[model samples]
Target chain A: MPDAPDAVEQAVRQVLTSINGDLTPTETMLLGELEALAQEIQRAKREISALSIGDISDSHIPVATDELDAVLAHTAEATNEILDCCEKLENTAPELPEGPAAVVNDAVTRIYEACSFQDITGQRIGKVVTALKAIEARLMRVTDRFGSVSSAPAEPQAPDTRTQGQQLANGPQLPGNASSQAEIDSLLASFD
Target chain B: MDKNTNILIVDDYKTMLRIIRNLLKQLDFNNVDEASDGSEALTKLRAGNFGLVISDWNMVPMTGLDLLKEVRADARLKNLPFIMITAESKTENVVAAKQAGVSNYIVKPFNAETLKEKIEKVMVHA
Candidate 1:
């Protein structure tokens, strides 16, 4: 066991260096190429692993988009339905105590009118959906590039048509940045 | 405000179009037409005799700002009252809309009252 380790290193050195009659120049060169090929293989493996789709963070984009879309769609639909029912109720004009009937009619119409929120919200949600779609397409390209042998479709480049100062069209800022209706009106006043 | 004045509502979303139409109806402005995007709005603006325009800001290919500019650039529609409805409350967006000759701007989630005020103001000024 004392000579075991030393003997193996000595023999390998002899094979590669050809200090002994055990190897030819061609065979030694071939061994060098094989060693290089092994290093190439390791590099290739690292690159493949780097692109593993499983490593991609669970993108909340799709989940958020789906939930937002569903909520917007449902809200819009329900609002429209209520509006229709209100219109019908207004039209029927059933015999009732005139005061209560007028109150109910006005309330119903207000509710019907309030339903317009759904349309604007639905529009905003649509913009979110479009942005999510662009993100999803990129993620799919990333997945396909490393996950599949076939060539993935090329990612479409969006044209740069943003306003000179505004690069991204950010819709409705979060609580902090979003100005209240009062602030907006004040700003308008100041402009005037 | 003339409730009988012909108005054009432009937005990419059908929902927004419907909502604007309904809101206009509530304001007693029933003579309203719809366009789904700035391009369509421009085309309709050319074809029809609309006195006012209410448009959304985030449409594709052409945005409400673009429509505003186009409307301003057009000889026939230059003075037509235009209001922009946007979720973008950024000062820059407001400034840009103002520069583009927008009659007024409405931040999103606005109610019928706000819509009426903006429309009436624009109509009066125009």
Candidate 2:
């Protein structure tokens, strides 16, 4: 039997396909990951909403409140961690596919829009969470695309013997300087 | 028409400032000063005897429009030629800038030739 979810899924797939051109394979994989994460977040939201919300016994209400709080806290922390990862990915990627970057930029813009909506009515943080999840998904796609492209064999180039300032002037370069190397080491240390 | 005409370039981004300065040097306009924002531009304007002012639109503390208005209001600096370069490409924004007494306007991500043409137009018209 045909279902509404099936139709929605088909539409989403069509949109993704239409917009997927020019993305590196890594970007596609990242985007796929992001989509999965967003689905998980949506399920979490549904589960949280499904809990009892009527004038139940006081003891039950406390338990419900505690459970809701715990869920909310977890979601918030996870979202923040995802955003941080996205930021790091963005910083490391030298160049991103233009189409995917536009999509990610659009997602970031949507996050701001969602935050504004929440601020006006003093609503729950769920709207913000949803927007953040969307942004995370977009960023993951962008990074993944960049990663795939970067990993591919490149056309040969002249050996780079330029100073740090010279390289910076030319544009972004891998960390080779003492200061930049130290920073990368520290960042890796933290990750470990 | 000395090559050493004191020119002030104002923008919020350090990268943009350097790019503009380099472009100006190529154009033989060597006497260039820079400010990171509108207020700093004004401070420099008040301190130095600059012949031309090239400013960006969006900035904190004050905007290029505010600086233009202030410059127009001040009797001493009223005749100092001002050109605005901005990312805003809307006709309304251009009209507003023209109404505010800007000598010229150039949309950002512009090339060296476009910048030179606009500057020349402003100089000729002025």
Candidate 3:
């Protein structure tokens, strides 16, 4: 009793329904891949945070010559670990997806590379810190020696008998007399 | 030098000044004076008999460099040794200080070791 045209339309509709149903397996496969990638990205981020490179570099550790080499070596080792992780991720990354998923994958890759670069940078900074510590230690020793040499008390003598040069070298003589003033002025001029 | 030998330390940071004072005390140089800025330091220098000056480069009212210039220009204090403590690590700053007749230079945040070396070097060379 159905019209011929209606019957033909129903057949076409059935075919379209079957074709859509066939895509279920493909969609499930893509979704599973996406879920795995998301989990991988999250795990990578957690690992990066656990490495704590920023905290280590920012810390105010007392630096010494002996420790400097060790610190740098440790930094390099840590960086290497991060790089290895990134290499693993790069190698295992699934075939590129289209649309927003591709964008996310690209972002994740860039982050991994950035983390690797930071590690390298941190090692270089560690070396510099070590060198600076050595310089600081040397300077402190010199300051200590000067302090001892300068602080030793000389034999006591009458103030008036002391030479003007001696008084200025000792310190500014109190009671700003013309003689002391003249002596200090003359000494200051020599620097010019 | 005895307990009477007056030394002046100038810096903007109170903590730094205290550290220097404590270090000076350890070396048996008990007669140490402190000023918080270049102007204050200059005032103290003029008011008291100071043997040596240790100053920070970056300070308000006057810089360590300016204070050095003033000390050098003054007839009475011309021979006074001036050491500059700075955070700047540039070669140019060091060269400039040497040219200005600075007795020595030390970069910060320095430990006690670097401080000692520079002081000895300046005392001997200057």
Candidate 4:
């Protein structure tokens, strides 16, 4: 009962459907994938929230930089102290016999040369600090794009429960982190 | 090398400046001045009459290479002895320093003898 054009159109549509097959299953599959992706994103956000790798404030970056700088400062100070001793000895070397003065001068010169280690180490640490700064900048950009999902800083750490030997020991630490060498020596002496 | 020739030592690290100054003193070159960076060194170079410039290659705001170029470009400072100190002995760094009119180069962690040798090689005093 349909008109000729309508009939032709319907026949063409039937042929196309037969060739292409039904599309409902494909559409359902796409929607299912979208829903799965949404769930995955939520899970990732939760995982990120649980991670304690510093907050969006990135206080860690500056702290790390300060630690590196402290390394430089401590080494420089020690090296300078050694150099001072060497220089003092060298200054008084001329008052000694010629042979002994020559020997002392040679030793002092070697010490001065070795003191260069501080400069090399400082340069190496400077490079690391520079790299950390660059990484922090990238992190800032990422945080800008997809804000921080992490929780606030953790609570204060619990008191030490380890035995005497198992006590926390990150010796050779930064300026304020651990006790000085003199303190440790005094403590070890008292323990005797 | 004239022991009394006024020398300018440039480094951002105070320790390095002190070390170099001490070494120069051992070499009997006590007439030395210090600058913490290239820009400050430039100001001193323009203001004083320094026979030699011993500078570290790396510094903020202005590098030794930049300072070398500036010195070479200046009519008065051109041909003044310039010794570059680099932490690494990379070939490209040597080539670049050479191209920038550096009179000589010294790699880091050098002994007094080496410093003396380089200073003797580069420094030309009137």
Among the numbered candidates, top TM-score falls to 4
Off by over 4 Å in 4: A1-39, A53-59, A148-192, B124-126
Scored by DockQ, the top model is 1
Candidate 2 runs further than 4 Å off: A1-192
Error of 3 at B55 (Å): 0.3
Candidate 4, residues A1-192: lDDT per residue as tens digits? 663344544555565567776636765465456556656766665575465435633688888898888888889889889988988998999999999999998898788878877877887787788778877776555444445435556458799864221121111223344343234324323433
What's model 4's lDDT at A6? 47
DockQ of each: 0.47, 0.03, 0.06, 0.09
Q: Global lDDT for candidate 1?
A: 0.75
Q: Which ten residues in a row have the lowest lDDT in candidate 4 chain A?
A: A164-173
The lDDT per prediction is 0.75, 0.60, 0.58, 0.73
On lDDT, the leading prediction is 1
Candidate ordering by TM-score (highest first): 4, 1, 2, 3
Question: What are the RMSD figures for all models against the true structure?
Answer: 8.9, 25.1, 31.6, 17.3
Q: Residue-wise lDDT of candidate 3 within B1-126, one digit each (tens)?
A: 344568899976554565566556545677888999778988889888887899877565677777787888888888887887664334445555566667876655454555666566556654
lDDT value for model 4: 0.73
Q: How do the predictions measure up, each by TM-score?
A: 0.68, 0.42, 0.39, 0.72
| Docking class for candidate 4 | incorrect
Estimate, for each residue in A1-192, the C-alpha lDDT of model 3 and write its tens digit.
543344444454456457675436655565456556656655665565565444333343453434666765675566556545644544445554556555644554444434433323333454566556565555454444433525566458556853221122211112322122233224434555
Candidate 1 deviates by what RMSD? 8.9
iRMSD, per candidate, in listed order: 2.9, 20.3, 19.6, 17.9
TM-score of chain A of 4: 0.56
Give the lDDT of residue B47 in candidate 2.
87
